[model samples]
Target: MEESQLERNRRNGFLALVLRPINWLKMLGEEVHWSFVIGVMIVYGISQGFAVGMSKVSTMYYMKDEQKVQPSELQVYLGLLQLPWVIKPLWGLLTDTLPVLGYRRRPYFIFAGFLSVTSMLALSIQRNLSLAFSLLSLIGVSAGIAIAVVAIDACVTQNSISHPSLAGDMQSLCGFSSSIGALAGYSLSGFLVHLVGPKAHVDSIPSAARLYCFFSSFYPLHNLSGVTLTSQGVFGLLSVPAGLVILVGMMLKESRVHKFTHRGVNEKFLDAGKAMWTALKFRDVWRPCLYMYLSLAVSLNIHEGMFYWYTDAKGGPSFSQHGLFASKNSNLSLITYHEISSWLNSDSELGCSDVLFWYGMQEVVGSIFSVGAVGSLSGVLIYQNWLKDHRFRDLLFWSQLLYGASGLLDLILVLRLNLKIGLPDYFFVVIDEAISMMIGRIKWQPLLVLSSKLCPAGIEGTFFALLMSIDHVGLLSSTWVGGLLLKFLKVTRTQFDNLWVAILIRSLMRIIPVFLLFLIPRSDPNLSILPEEMLKMKKGDNTLESENTEMVSLVDST
Candidate 1:
């Protein structure tokens, strides 16, 4: 009988391999409701991941080409967009304590969807909006995304509590959905921009007429008859995610909450504040929290300055909205290519002379984003497999070191040092993006784990939200500081001579966080960082405990 069983196992190995995924899917369906699964995919996967990736590329191009915002000012405006995330705790609290039309999650999700859809539609259809309005529209979009994320996070938290054994699996599902959606979104961003063209057509006077005016030569004039989609059209497509979000709201299985009292809500808020204050009094909690804030604040995000340089610098490989590639050494080659394309257009009576000039060129920036997505996912895998068990202090120290080291790639790219080293601009940027994203993700993973570890027992939800908000505040601070740095260095729309200096400053500041490593706990992750008394709240504390046991589940699931 043993021999027969061994033979059967050997024969079914290939079949088992094929059925494993099917079996996993079956188990997932049994463990989690289908509505919850779909809601997560739409919220995290489409709204957060795909829409965000596409929006980043489109917004940069719009601000740079249409709004004409300089790198320094753009940095400030970009920072403003993060305001919603900085106040994420408020959104979480509202979802927890306040319900509209007797529904908590569904109303917020629907409102988020409505907000996102309107903002995206506004951006897409309106061509000549003022800079202030454009920024406001973008902020609205950001707010919508943030609200939806908070709502979905609340759902995840509730489910984690209801099904304790499936908490890890649920988190994994969320992470995987986000990563895969991000990868597809980023990989397609540049191609879609290139295909749709990054900017609306400016009504330029025919070049023939201008030449005729200057040279008094009889140049033939022809109307541009070719039609192409613009970046606005791409933005219009982003409405798909918002539409899905609305559907998720309508389809989500949530029971009606018929009870409400303003006094009760106020008391809950007071309890949450008191609990958070109590948790922060613990040195074990506040130390790491302070470190997390400092680590992010000191990094100094100068991405706008670097982005403008990447697309506009003469001596560097250019990555632009239109299929643009320019380098100091390749000017003649580019001119030749343009002239050849022009000649081809001359032979075609139906085509515009300049329309096809950039044909077949790659959207280099979008491709870099795509590559970075892969790197981020790889970082997640690496941490899960190897680094998840490491002591927090050691893991953070090496990741920070590598993070600072990898930042030098930006300096190299800015200085055109990669070209001197025989590596082309496009190839080098891809490698740099991948490495930087991987290191950044690695640095962030430990911080997330640490944040989860630090959350106290009863008020886990509110405290965790507060911690996330602190991180966003740090991000806001970093962005604003980077903008000031760029302004101080005189980096401008066409002037990038000092951009390298800004990069150097940022890279150097990335190392400052390393010295603050003393603030992090050196204990293994398996051990609780909090004291026993803190973890064990009095049984009589019903207000905070009853309400937030579900909330802390969100932390553990993360």
Candidate 2:
């Protein structure tokens, strides 16, 4: 029988050789696939729902509902809401690496979900929201969630070793699951207030346009008099989904795998210390990490931050005109993403949107399809081609560079539109996003897989969690960073014209990190080692290789 990496560790440290249930289960039937899809669905459903739902209420649903808040205030509010997530890395380290109930990863994950559900429920009870309560609610939900994310990523990474070859596919399918959750959550949350009205549709265009004035929520109240008129008072109700996921998770024949797991005081400390040291030692790793962080930061910033411009702020190509165009463009992208990938990519009419909702959805759809068809496949092709002499260092580098350039493409698209320069700005933005997603899909999973392969035995979960934690901080930053940049753009709630410079500056900032990706070692320091020899090689520690490893981590541990 083959001595796996863990078995090899017996010679290194008694505690290091202990094999968890996860390893045996890897040989079991690959049932984790369903859980992954569902888990991801729940994750995206809740996480993204929180991210976008608040914005929807402020931008569309609650606009007329709250008079005290102006577009300016909402602009700042959107930026402020992400503050908890910005520091989420700290939260992850708290529950993940630390102990609770004598269990490190499990207890925190369970409690994290509970807090998430409770936070959602609490927020829903408050129909009348103040900035303080809202921020608190956001924080509570996000805090629990930040912890949940780390746990989920760790679990997924461990679970994934079973079908290790499918890591990329696993990640891609997870994307779809997340999309399903987002679209489902977004679509349903508004059903009560926006779709079926307590009152019938009003006659005439003006009355129809202002129909929000007459609708009432499921929760009855006299104050609801003009409640539906403005989306001002809506609660995210993210708890509903959280509750559902919890129930479903309970049915998941518990991951008894932890039972086989062994962790001694000294062993765990060394594991964590070694992992942390390795994380810091890898230049190639951090390079891609930095690029990803900044890219997502800018993309999301442009996405959420620019909405004020699309709405009443810049007053783009008239709401009606922009709406029709944007609607058409979005529809096109959505079809291209989900439908066409099913081999249905036919020539068709494109749509555009003035509404942030549809435009954003369009981008989401584009990214999904790109990930599966073009992006993942492209990276796989590159990897396959590199099977000869190891050149993935360049592959990884170029992939990241392309993603950065895609960011630059965003600026170019906006410039073209702003200057009435070439093709429409939407064209540039949409294509840029698609390419970005493609490169992103290609770049990220390889990085993760490489990390896992190279990590010293016994510290897989801890180190994997750390990598994800860092990337997420970057993801969170994407949400608010654009808003900060927009503050300087000051183009206004009415004039849509002069803010291209912000895009340019952000793109330039984003590009700087791509060059840094070169700092990562070009090869896996551990894959070359046999399972028997692996334990002796501490995870996060590098092995010197003769395979022409242009990109490698380190032989040193913190």
Candidate 3:
């Protein structure tokens, strides 16, 4: 009977491993989770676009000095002003972890929505304000949207962790929603921007020598200039939909997400502090956290490298001149398939929001290719029972090493591939991007899973928020370092071939963390089961002794 029970338990464990969470939406009838995800995506996608349009683009076109604004002036002004976004994570950690009305995800979503919407409305009102005031106003709008973004991310992260089965569906919905936002905003921005003519024809000047005629064709040849850079930094237009989706999603009555009910009382708000301390106490946490930061830094640097590559090697001319903007509107750009005007407009205004929007677009292509990156994790989810037999550390180590190798391979593609044709280079870029995404999926998901499992039942939400904070810090740090690094590298549009070196350095950063991966404590299978079976054995031993004593008494009576 004992052997039979043991065999049955082993079989049950095997089934558990094979059926871990991935299709949570499908399991829940595709109604609740999927609908909510889609609805929020649309709302936020639209909101994100609006946010960019009102704050960044409008501010750019607000008219400077009455003698048509120069792109350089706006660029210089924005360069100094966009610093608020980098520190947003610090405040984000606060809002996400604190509960406003006896719930974690609900109240925060409402606040974020309110801030995001109100800020945009205010910006639209002050569209033609003075330069200093306009710059300040843009910062205000950025603050509101930035706060809202982290709050919404908090919801998705916590929700998915609670329902592991829904991880894949959640990520898919996110992809669809983010991509929609990017597509709509980018496509629209090109057409609506304030047009600056490329020609500068002065009525008083003689036609013999037009001073700016040699500068760019974006301006009329004899007229000297007709183009104008028509923007502030409306980049948020691309991501506004993401925020709108989350805002409306506050309508979702937090699903019955029942694994263990997280502690949600009014007094429980202080747990965020506890979660922070808990995470910090574990020296082991730093190993992977370092890896995450290093990887993001490398990715950002590569992005900078690519920007230089496009300007110098792939595309002709520098953005410092006005003619390029005219060229962009006249179908002289790479993304001509979609007629996105402001993105390439001669006088475009951009905000930091544009960086995030483009990043989201890149992630879409990357997510599709990350299946191999998380292959081991998928196997673990699919064959969870085998995990009882296998060591968790082994799984983690192998996954990180594989990811590291993929990063290196990406470098090779950039350097060695003698793609005489642009199509071949594009193909390699896609592959490299896919590999990078795959490794990220594999590496990052595990961090969430481990934290979710290890966190004490009562403080799960707060603990989860704390983990997210660490993740954000990693990203924020990368942004800071990337800015300085780009400035230092002087990585210009002219030096395209040197991008391979950037790729190689970025790939190499992953190596240091590979050694640290093994230090993390593996999940203990022994603790996850019921102790009632052992208790039953102890009870059975006393009953057998009592029966034996009864038998002895009967024999003595005989």
Candidate 4:
């Protein structure tokens, strides 16, 4: 009887370990509000996931293969696309202060959906790089999805004041929903690239225009498989989610205050401007903003640029017949080719399409079993369970350090150091991506938590938007600076002799931001308004009410 019991216990324990993630997800689902979960799913899943996925793959191959643009030149155009995100304060201001047809959030949501659909449709049909850049920027403006996210987040944050525990649960939902969206996008992007293959070259301008028109109107069937999966088809499919977003927007029920504020459009604009100005003048608000900007500006991300060059470059670890080459400079020397070639052998060079296909496969496998998904899920669980009591500053510092350390994997892969231990190139690539993504997700949770704590009541959307915009600017700056570094180092598709130097510089730069941790506040993660601050906000609300009453009286008298 004892032996039978022990055997049964071991079997149950093994099954539990296998099903732990599903159980965690179920627990999380029960903890969060259903409406919040649904809102995040729609906003992140369809809008952010589908649109971003299609754009990334399409833009990358379109420029690299069709236009034959260099990595540095391509990064500049990508940076230009980030302009809409950088000026997100304007969107926040418009939505916060101004009402459209007696609604603040719904109208913008509809506009964003429509704009996204049109821009994506245009991108699918148009092959002009310049035109593509313009469309990309326009899509950025149609980011009504973000507005919806901000509005929902504000609601959750307000509720958290009374229910402190709800804050972490909601943040977890946001991160989890976002990861789901990203995984879907990442998986589809590569598949689409493989399906579309490469854009054909045309002799005349008119002929190219005609070709685009044909593709726009109808997808050409693939000769080998007799399947229709043109670039236009893929983009058109992506636009369906945007259409769904518009439907969701149309169905949203606005609050009474949102409807009440509808009486004064112009007045709301002035009020919004004033509110933004006031928020900016506050030391607490501006200090974090300044710190985030400065830290992001100095932080380097040449790794992405270098990765592209390394993968596509001939004679690199992935393709070079003679594994690793010795660098004349001691700083560049790491691992030898012979050491790597023992387990990993490169037979041939990979074309652009081949590279994209491999990436897609990696994304697909990574989505299913990668540390990224596991780590993201784990992060939410850890924060909600164990780390909720920990200080934001301390969590952020440690996570950032781990994230920076993950950068070393890129260097190892570049130098074929992983192969020394009998790991295949593809295995190393997947592992590196998983580790980096896991740490990256861990780092993201605290920022969202902190942002929720920092937002004031009245201008929550605008303030959060401003904070998110600053974060995006940091990302954009990284891309732009990385491009410049790549160009300056002469790290091209065929040339990567100085790639190590750029990677080393980026790694060192990642560490510098850790020292500036003093800029962040060490207060409670659930920091809410003090009694005095709440009183001030109540008075401001009263003043607004009085002003509206006076205006109504004047209108009635007239």
Q: Which candidate's TM-score is highest?
A: 1
Q: Please estimate how well model 4 matches the true structure, expressed as its whole-model Cα lDDT.
A: 0.58
Which candidate should be chosen as best, given lDDT against the real structure?
1
Q: How many residue pairs clash in each candidate?
A: 0, 35, 58, 1
Instruction: Please provide TM-scores, in order, for all candidate models, with all chains considered together.
Output: 0.81, 0.61, 0.53, 0.75
Where does candidate 1 have its weakest 10-residue lDDT segment? 210-219
lDDT of 4 by residue, 259-372 (tens): 354446566567656765776677655766776776666667674455455446564543212222222232312233233222123332322222111111212332323335
Q: Select the stronger candidate by lDDT from 1 and 4.
A: 1
Q: Between the candidate structures 3 and 4, which one is better when assessed by lDDT?
A: 4
The TM-score between candidate 2 and the true structure equals 0.61
Question: Could you tell me the lDDT of residue 192 within candidate 4?
Answer: 55
Q: What is model 4's C-alpha RMSD?
A: 10.3
Output candidate 3 Cα RMSD: 16.7
User: How does candidate 3 fare on TM-score?
Assistant: 0.53
Q: Kindly indicate the candidate among 1 and 3 with the higher lDDT.
A: 1
What ranking of all candidate models by TM-score puts the best one first? 1, 4, 2, 3
